[model samples]
Target: MDDNRTDKVLLYKGVKTMIFAVLTLFMGPIILSMALSQPENKLYIPLLVVGLLICAFAVFLIFKGIRLIMNSMFKK
Candidate 1:
């Protein structure tokens, strides 16, 4: 019999990563907007940089999560 069962542990990890990525996605835009609204602030540049980095990280996390979920479902 071919046992093609999904790996629950990896699937769970992927779900968790996706959730975190969603939160980061929201946070990045909020931070970027806040920084844009206060261009004169000394922390504006740093906040903008951080926001961009967070946005990039969210994208990475999304890709990673999808890959993990796919692996869990398809890998032996």
Candidate 2:
């Protein structure tokens, strides 16, 4: 017989990561928009770069969260 059970800790971690990712995803666009709205501002370039990095990190976190969740559910 095989023992198959979900790893609660991993699932929780994954859920946490997903939540963070979602927040980052929303923030990225907002930051980018802010940066765009002030093209002449000294902070524009830095904000743009930070926004882009946040967006990329959000994507990475999403994938990582999914993988963690999948592993929690499927791995033995």
Give me the displacement of residue 14 in model 1, in angstroms: 0.4
**Cα lDDT of model 1 by residue, 1-76, tens digit:** 8879999999999999999999999999999999999999999999999999999999999999999999999985
Off-target runs (Cα >4 Å) in candidate 1 are: none
lDDT for each candidate structure = 0.97, 0.97
Query: What clash pairs does model 1 have?
Result: none
Q: How accurate is candidate 1 locally (lDDT)?
A: 0.97
Model 2 TM-score, all chains together: 0.95
Worst 10 residues of 2 by lDDT: 67-76
Q: Output the lDDT of residue 56, model 2.
A: 99
